[model samples]
Target chain A: MTLAQWSFDLLLAGGLLWLGWQALFEKRRFSAVVHFMAFNLLMALVWVRLSAPDIALAEAAIGAGVTGALLLTALGRLPSGTSSGAHPHRWHPHWRYLAVISACISTAWLIAVVPQLPSPGLAGEIEAVMPATGVDHAVTAVLLNIRALDTLLEVAVMLAAVVLVWSLGPTLRPLPPATILPGLPALSRLLHPLFLLVPTYLLWRGTHAPGGAFPAGAVLGAGGVLMLLADEVGWMQRQHWQRLLRLLLVSGLALFVLVGLGGLLMTGTFLSIPLGVARLLIMAVEIAMALSIALMLMALYLYGEPGQ
Target chain B: MSDYYATVAALLCGMAVIGLFRAHDLLHRILALNVLASAVFLLLVTLARTESGTDPVPHVMVLTGIVVAVSTTAAALALTIRAYERRRQREDER
Candidate 1:
C-alpha cells in the first residue's frame, strides 16, 4: 500500500480505539451512545479498507443507524430522575480488571493462531457455483442460495424477536410527544419520498451489487420509526391493524419456509432450488424476506401494541 | 497489514468484555455487548481478506450477525423497560 493508504488505515484504527474507550468510560450514558455510534461509522470505513463493501453497508445502516435509534429509545424510556449513569461505587470494579486481564490473554492466544489461518477459504468454492445460484454477487449467493437454511432461520429469529417485544406491552410514549414534523415541512417532504426510493433501489441493486435485503429492510424500518416519531396516533394503533401487522411480521419467515419446502420437493435437498429459474425463485424469496424483515424491525421499534 | 487490523479488532473485544463487566446499568451492558459483536464482525471481515480478494461467505455471516444483534438488542431493551415499569407501578401501589 502507498504511504497515504497506510496513513488512512492507521487513522481509522486509532479513531476506533479512542472512540470505543470514550464510549465505555464516559460519565454519561448519552455520550457513551454517541461515541458508540461514531465507532460504528468508523468501523464501516475499516470494512471498506478490508475490501468488503457489503459488510460496510450493513455495518453503517443497521449496526450504527438502526441500533443507535433503538438504544436512544430505550434510554428515553428509563426513569428520568434515576441518574442511570451514576454508579454507587465510583472506584473501578476489581472484577473488571480481572476480566480485562483474561480478555488480553485470550486475545494474545488468538493472535498466535491467526497467522496460520487459511486464506481464500470458501470464496473460490462459492464463486464457482455462483452461476448456478443465479446471482452475480457471491455474498447474495451464499446468503440466499448455498447456505440459505441459515438465512431462513435468521428470519425466524427476527420474527420471534418481534413476538417477544410485543409481549412486553404497549408503546412507551414520550410526554408532550416528539411529532416535530409539522415544524419542519421541508425535512418531512425530503424524507418521505427518499425513503420510498432508497429501499426499493437497495433491494433491486442486491442482485448485482453490495446492497441487499438486510439494508433495504433496515431502511424501510427506519422510515417506519420516523413515521412513529412524527405523530401520536401512529400506524399500528388500531385493534384491527395490530392483527394485520402481526401477520406482516411473520410473513417473511412463512414465505421463506414455504419456498424452502417447495425447493425440497423439486430437488432432493432442502432449500435446493433447481438450476432452471433460480433467479426468479431467489428474487421472490428476497422480496418476501425484505417486506417481512421491514415489518419485524418496525414492530420491534414500536415494542408491543401501539398505545391508544 | 490485515494482521494489524485484526489485532485492533481483538483489543476492541477485550475492551468490550471489560466494559460489560464494569457496567452497572442494563443499557450500558447492552451497549458493551454491541461493541463486542462489532469486534467479532471486524475480525471475521479482516480475516476473510486474502491476497486474491475478500471472501464472500464471512461477509454474509457478519451481515446476518448484524441483523441478529439488532433484533436481540431490541428484545433485551423491551424487557428492561418492562421490568422498570413494573417496579415503578409496584412502588406506587405500596
Candidate 2:
C-alpha cells in the first residue's frame, strides 16, 4: 500500500480504537453512549472503505440509528448517575502475566496470518447464477433468493425475540410526557411521512442498489420507535389495532412459508422460485420480509408489549 | 490494503475483548459487545476484498448479522432495564 493509504487506514483504525476506549471506559454514562454512536458512524465509513455499501447502509441505520435510540431510551429509564459505584473482579496476581502473554501471542499470530491470507469467497459462483435470481443486485439476489432459507430463519429469530420481549410484560412505568423533550409533537409529525417515504424508496432501491429490507426495515423501525416514544401510538394498544399489529408482525414468515411451499408444489423443491416468475416472486418476498422485519424491530424497541 | 484493515480489525477485537471484561456493568458491557461485533464484521468484510472484486455473500451475511445483533441487544437491554427499574423501586420504598 502507498504511504498515504497506509496513513489513512492507520488513522481510521486509531480513531475506532480511541472511540471504543472512551465508550467502554468513560466515567460518564451519557458521554460513553455518545462516543459509541460516533464509533458506529465511523464504522459505516469503514464498511464503505471495504466496498460494502450494503453493510454501510445497514450499519448506519441499525447500528447507529436504531441502536443509538435504544441505548438512549434505556438510559433514560434506568437509574441515571455517575459510574463510581460498581467494581470489577479483583484479578489474581498471576492473571496479569497470563493475560499479557496470551495477548502478545495472539497479536503476533494475527499479524503473521492477516497479511498473507488469500481472498476467497463465492463471488464467481453467485455471479454465474445472478440472472436466475431475478434481482438486479447480486446482494439482494443472494439474500432473498439464493440463501433465502437463512432469511426465513432470521425472521423466525426476530419473531422469537419479540415474543421474548412481550413475555416480559411492560416494565416501563410510564413517566410524564414532559420528561422526553420540547416540541415533541412537531418532531414526530415531521418525521412520520419521511420515514414512510424513505423506506418505500429503499425497498424499491434494493432491487438494483445498496438498499434492502434490512436498511428499509431499520428506518421504518426507527419511525415506529419515534411514534412510540412520542406516545403518539397509544391507538395501537386498542383491541382492533392489536390484531392488525400482530398480523403485520407475522405476515412476513407466514407469506414466506406459503411462497416456499408454492415453490415446492411447482418446482419439486422448496424456496426455489421458478425462472419465469422469479422477478415478481422475489419482489413479493422482499416486501413481505421488509414489513415483518420493520415491525419486529419496532416491537423489540418497545419497553415491553404494548396493551399488555 | 486488505492487510491494513485486517490488522486494525484484529486490534479492535483485542481491545473490545479487554473492554468487555473490564466493563463495570451491563450497559457498558453491552456497548463493548457491540464494538466487538463491529470488529468481527470489519474483519469479514476486509477479507472479502480481493484482486478481482468484492463478494456479495459476505456482505449479505454481515447484513443479516447486523439485524440479529441489534435484536439481541434490544432484548438484553429490555431485560436489564426491567431489573434496574425493579431494584430502584425497592430502594425508593426502603
Candidate 3:
C-alpha cells in the first residue's frame, strides 16, 4: 500500500479505537450514546474502505440511524431521578470477568491460528461452479443458492425472535405523553414518503448491485419505528394493520420453502430451480422476506417485548 | 505496501478492543463494539486487496456482516429501551 493508504488506515483505526475507549470509559450515559453514534459512522467508513458499498449502506442506516434512535429513546424513558454517577456494583462479578477473559483469550488464539490452517481443495471447485448459478457474486451464490438452507434458517430465526418479543405482553402501553419529543410529528410526516420509496429501490438494486433484502427490510423497519415513535399509528389503526402484517411476515419464508420443495419434484434436489427461474424465485422470495422482516422488526421495536 | 497498511489497521484493532473493555456504560460498550467490528472489516478488506486478482468474496461477506450487525443492534437497542422503561415504571410504583 502507498503511504497515503497506510496513513488512511492508521487514521481510521485510531479513530475507531478512540471512540471505543471513550464509549466505555465515559461516565455519562448521554455521552456514551454520542460516542456510540460516532463509532458506528466510523465503522461505516471501514466498510467503505473495505470496498463493500452494500454493507456501508446497511451499517449507516441500521447501525447508526435506527440503533442510535432506539438507544436514545430508551435513555429518554429512564427515570430522571436515578443516580447517574459511578455504580461499581453494576460491573460483572469477578468470576464472570475471569470467564470472559478466558473466553477472549481462547478466541484470540483461534483467530491467530486461522491463517496457518490448511486450505480446502474444494475452493476451486466452488469457484468453477459459481458462474453457472447465474450469480456472479460468489457470496450471493452461497447465500441464495449453494447453501440456501442456511439462509432459510436464518430468516426463520428472525421471525422467531419477533414472535418471542410479541408474546411478552401488550407492547402498546400508553406512556404519559410527556416523553414524546417536540416536532416529531412534523418530522415523521416529511420523511414518510421517502421511507416508502427507498426500501423498494434498495430491494430492486440488490439484483445487480450490493443491496439486498436484509438491508432494505431493516431500513423500512427503521421507518416504521420512526412512525411508531411519533405515534402516527393509533391503537385502532395498528390493530387493523397487524393482521395484514402477519400474512406478509410469513409470505417470504413460505415462498422460499415452496419454491425449494417444488424444485425437488422436478430436479430431484432441494432448491434446484433452474437458473432463469432461480433469479425470479430469489427476487420474489427477497421481496416477500423484506416485507416480512420489516414488519417484524418494526413490531419488535415498538412493542419492546419479544414472542407474540 | 499492503502489509504496512495492514499492520497499522491491526494496531487500531487492539486499541479499539482495549476501549471496549474499559467502557462502563451500556452505550459506550455498544460504541466500542462497533469500533471492534470496523477493525475486523478493515482487516478483511485489506486481505482481499492483497490478492493478485481482485476477488469479490470479502466484499460479499462484509455486506452480509453489515446487515446482520444492524439487525442485531436494532433488536438489542429495543431490548435496552424496554428494560429502561420497565425500570422507570417500577421506580414510579415504589
Candidate 4:
C-alpha cells in the first residue's frame, strides 16, 4: 500500500471518531446535529473508500441528507427541556461506569475476532450468477433478483414505519402547523427540476452502474420533503390525490409480491424470473420500488397520520 | 488494509454503545443508535472485501440497512416528540 493512501485512511478514521464523539457529547442540540451530519457525510466517504459506490450513494442521500433533515425537524418540534443535553438521573454514575466497561470489553472482543473470521467470498458467487439476474450491476442484481425477498421485506418495513409514525398521530395539536421559512420557496423552486432529473437518471443508470432504486427514491423523497417544508404539499391532501398517494405508498410491495406469485405459478420457485424477461421484470420492479420508497420516505418525514 | 477499517469500526461501536448508556435525552439516544448502525455497516463492508474485489451482497445489505435505519429513526423521533409535548401539556395543567 502507498504511504499517501495509508495516511488518508488514518485521517478519515480519526475524523470519524472525533465527529462521533462530538455528536454524542455536545451540550447544545444544534451543535450535536451539526456534528452528526458531518459524521454521516464522512461515513459516506468511507463507504466510497471501501469500494462500495452503490452504498456510498445511498448513504449520502438517505443516511446523511434525509436523516439529517428528520433530526433537525425533530429538534425544532421537541419540547424545550428535552433538548439534546443529557439530563440528570438517579444512578447515573453507576450506569455510565458500567457502560464504559462494557464498551471496552466489546471493542476488545471485536478487534480480536474480526480479523480471524473467514471471508465467504459472496462476490464471486454473485458474479457467477450475474448473467441470470439480467442486471449488469451486481448490487442491483442481488438486491432485485438473487436475494430479492430481503428487498421486498425492506420495502414493507419502510411502509410499516410510516404506518407506525402515523398511528402515533398528531399530538394535542397538529405540530404547530407548518410554517414557511424565508427563502425556502425560492430554493425549492430552483432545485425542483434537478430532483426530477436526478432521480430519473439514477433509475436509468441503476441497471448498469452504482445507482439504483434506493438512491433514486431518496432523492425524490428529499424533493417531497422540500415541498412539505415549503407548504406546497397541500395538494397531497386533496381527495383525488389521497388515493393516489395511498396506492403509490404500497405499489412497491404489491408489485414485488405479484411478481413473486407469477414466478411461483410459472416455475416451481418464488421470485424466480425467467431468463428472457429478467431485465424487464427487474426494471419494472425497480421503478415501482423507487416510487413507493420515495412516497413512503416523504410520509415518514411528515409524520402525519395518513387518514387525518 | 481492510483490517484498519475493522479496527476503526470496533472503536466506533464502542463509542456508540457508551453514548447510548449515558445519553438521557431521546434525541441523543437516537443519534447514538445511528452511530452504532454506522459501525455495523463499516464492519460489514470491510469484511466484504476479498482478494478480487468487494462483495455486492454486503454492499446491498448495507444499502438496505441505511434505509431501515432512517425509517426506524423517523418513527422513534416522532414518538419522542409526541411524548415530550404531552409531558409539557401535563406540566402546564399542573
Candidate 5:
C-alpha cells in the first residue's frame, strides 16, 4: 500500500477507537449516542476500505442511521429526573480496570500466537455457483441462495423481536413532537418520494450490484422513523391500521416459509431453487423480505403501539 | 495495514468489555454491547481479507449479524423503557 493509504487507515483506526470510547465512557448519554452513530458511520467506511461494499451499505443504513433514531426514541421515553451519568462510585470501578487489562493482554497474546486463517475461503466456492444462484453479486448469493437457511432464520428472528416488543404494552408517543426541529416536517415531506424510490431502486439494483434487501429495507424503515419523528403519522393511530401493520410485520417470515415450502415441492431439497427459475424465485423472496423487513424495523422504532 | 485493524479490534473488544462491565445505566450498557459487536465485525472482515480479494462468506455473516444486532437492541430498549415506566408508575401510586 502507498504511504498515503497507510496514513488514511491509521486515521480511520484512531477515529474508530476514539469514537468507541466516547460512545461508552462519555458523561452524557446523549453524547454517547451521537458518538455511537458516528462510530458506526465510520465503520461503514472501514468496510469499504476492506473491499466489502455490501456490508458497507448495510452498516451505513442500519447501523449508523436506523440505530441512531432508535436510540434517540428510547432516550426520549426514559423516565426523567433520574441522575443520569452520575455513578455513585467512591473510586473508578476497579473491576473494569481489571477486565480491560486482562482482555487486552489476552487479545494481544491470541493474535500473536494464532496462525492466519487461509484466505479465499468460501469466496471461490460461492463465486463458482453465483450464476446458478440468480445473482451476479457474491454476497447476495451467499445470503439468499446458497446458505439461505441462515437468511430465513434471520427474518424469523426479526418477527420474534417485533412480537416480543409489542407485548411490552403501549407507551406514549411524543405528541406535537416537542423535540423535532421546526423545519423537519417540511424536509421529511420533501424527501418522502426519494425514500420510496430509493429503496425500490436499491432492491431492483441488488441483483447486479452492492444494493440488496437489508439496506433497502433499512432505508425504508428509516423513512418510517422520519415520518414518525416529524409527527406526520397521525393515521397510524387508527385501530384497524394496527392490524394491517401487524400483518405486514408477520408477512416477511410467513412468505419466506411459504416460498421455502414451494421450493421444496419444486425441487427435491428444500430452499434450493431450480436452475431454470433461480432469478425469479430469489427476487420474489427478496421483495417480500424487503417489505417485511421495512415494516418490522418501523414497528421496532415505534417501541409500542402508537399512543393516541 | 490490516494488522493495524486487528490491533484496533483487539483494543475495541477490551474497551467495550470494560465499558459494558462498568456501565450502571441500561442505555450505557446497550451502547457498549454495540461497540463490542462492531469489534467482532471488524475482526472478521479484516481476517476475510486475502492476497487475492476479500472473502464473501464472512461478509455475509457480518451483514446478517448487523441486522440481528439491531433487532436485539430494539428489544432491549423496549424492555428498558417498560421497566422504567413501571417503576415510575409504582412510585407515583405509592
Candidate 6:
C-alpha cells in the first residue's frame, strides 16, 4: 500500500466498472464482445493487485485468452445478419436500467458493511486442524483433504459436463486454411521445440511458483488451438486423434478418484492418503487435470467434427 | 486509496453484467459472462490482499474458481455450438 499502488488499483476498478456498463448498455453485439474482452484483461490485472499471482495467470490465460477465442469462434458460427443488425425496437425501458442500478448499489453497500461483521472464529479452528491433516496450504487442506469428497464431486461435475456436450451432435465448423506467415515457417520450425519447453517448464514451476494446473492447462490448450488455427494439422488427421483426446479428457478425474480411493484402503478415509504420498498423488492428479482441462477446452472451441 | 481499485473492479463487474443483459447474440452474452467472472475474481483477490502478506485462502479460492470457470465455459460453448447447428439445419429446410 503505497499511494501509487492504491491509486493504480482504483484506476483499474473504475475502468472495469465503466467497461462493464458500456458492454451491457451497448446495442451492438460486436462492440460488446470487444468491451467484454477488455473487461476480462482488466480483471486479470486486478487479480495481480490482490497478491494472487496464480489466479492472475489463470485469468489472463483462460478467462481472457481461451474464453475470448471461444466467443469469437461462436460468433463466427452464427449468421452474420443476426449479430450485425440493429434491434427492431428502440432502447427505452428506463425502469429496467434503474432497477439494475439500484440492485448494484445495494450489493455494494452490503459488501462495505462486511468489515463490521463479527469474525467467524473458524480461522483458528481450521488452522489448528491443518497440521493434523498433514497439509501446509490452508486452502489445499480445505479443498483436497478435509473436504475431499466435495472436490471429487466437483471433478465429476466437470466430467459430466463434457459427456453432455459430446452427446450433442456435430458442432465443429471447418476452419479456414492457413496461409504462409511471411518468412515464419523457419521461425515456427525453430520455435516448435521452444513451445514444448514452455508447458513443461510451467508444470514444473507450479510446485513452488504461482503457476499451477489451471494456467498450465490453459497454455497447453492455447498451443493446440493455435496449431489448429494455423492449419498445421488437417481436419481428417485431427479426427483420428478424437479417441485419444477423449481418454485424455477423463484421465485427470480418473487418476484423482483412484488415488483418493487408494487412501481409503490404507488410511481408512477417502482422500486421506499419507502426507508424502498425498503430495505425489495430488501432483499426479493435477497433471491429469491439466491435460483433461486443456483437451476439453479445445474440443469445446472446436465444437464437433473439424471437417464438417 | 485501496477504495479506488475496488471501485474500478466494481465498475468492471457492472459493465460485464450490462454486456450480458444487452447482448442479443449468444456468443456476445457468453463473452459478457466471462467478463463478469473476471471482475468477480479481481474483486475477491483485491479484498483478500488487505494484510501485509498475501492470503492463501483467496489464492486457493481463485484457483478453484478458475477451474470451475473454465469447465463451465467449455460446457456452455458446446451447448451453443449445438444450438447453432440445429438452427442452421432448420434454416436449410425452410
TM-scores of the candidates are 0.92, 0.92, 0.78, 0.94, 0.93, 0.82
Any residue pairs clashing in model 1, and if so which? none
lDDT score, residue B51, model 2? Answer: 64
Better of 3 and 4 by lDDT: 4
> Clashing residue pairs, candidate 2?
none
Q: For model 4 chain A, where is the 10-residue window of minimal lDDT?
A: A171-180
- Mind giving the per-residue lDDT tens digits that candidate 2 earns over B38-61? 988888888887766878887888
Q: State the lDDT of candidate 2 residue by residue for A1-308, as single tens digits.
A: 69997787778888988998899778678899999999999999888878888888878878888899889888887667653224567798689668866776786787678877776777888889998888889889999899999888888887888898888886365722437676777899998999999989998999898887888888888788777777787766766688889998999899889989999999999999998988888788778888888788777877587765
- Lowest summed-lDDT stretch of 10 residues in model 6 chain A? A114-123
Candidate 6 regions with alpha-carbon error over 4 angstroms = A82-98, A104-151, A176-191, A233-240, A305-308, B1-4, B50-53
| All DockQ scores | 0.63, 0.64, 0.33, 0.71, 0.63, 0.46
- Tell me the tens digit of each residue's lDDT in model 5 across A1-308: 89999999989999999999999898687889999999999999999998888888889888998899889878877755433333556446577567667877887775674336455466666667777887888878888888899999998888889888877877455633555598999999999999999989988988888888888888888888788788788766777687777777777778778777878899868888887888877788788888998888877887876533
Residue A35 lDDT (model 4): 96
B-chain TM-score for every candidate: 0.96, 0.92, 0.87, 0.96, 0.97, 0.89
Residues A201-272, model 3: lDDT tens digits: 988877767777767887887888788778786642455566666777788788889988988997899988
User: Distance from true position, residue A124, model 2, in Å?
Assistant: 0.7
The segments of candidate 3 whose C-alpha lies over 4 angstroms from its true place after superposition are A1-6, A79-127, A136-139, A172-183, A235-237, A305-308, B1-62, B74-94
For each candidate, the alpha-carbon lDDT, in order, equals 0.80, 0.83, 0.66, 0.86, 0.83, 0.65
The TM-score measured for candidate 5 stands at 0.93
Report the number of the highest-TM-score candidate.
Answer: 4
Model 1 agreement with the true structure over A124-152: per-residue lDDT tens digits? 78777888888888888889999999999
lDDT of 6 by residue, A218-285 (tens): 77776666565665545434667766766777887788789878988998987777876766666676
Best by DockQ: 4
lDDT of each residue in A44-91, candidate 4, tens digit only: 999989888888888888888889988988888875564533355657
Reference-based lDDT, residue A195, model 4: 93
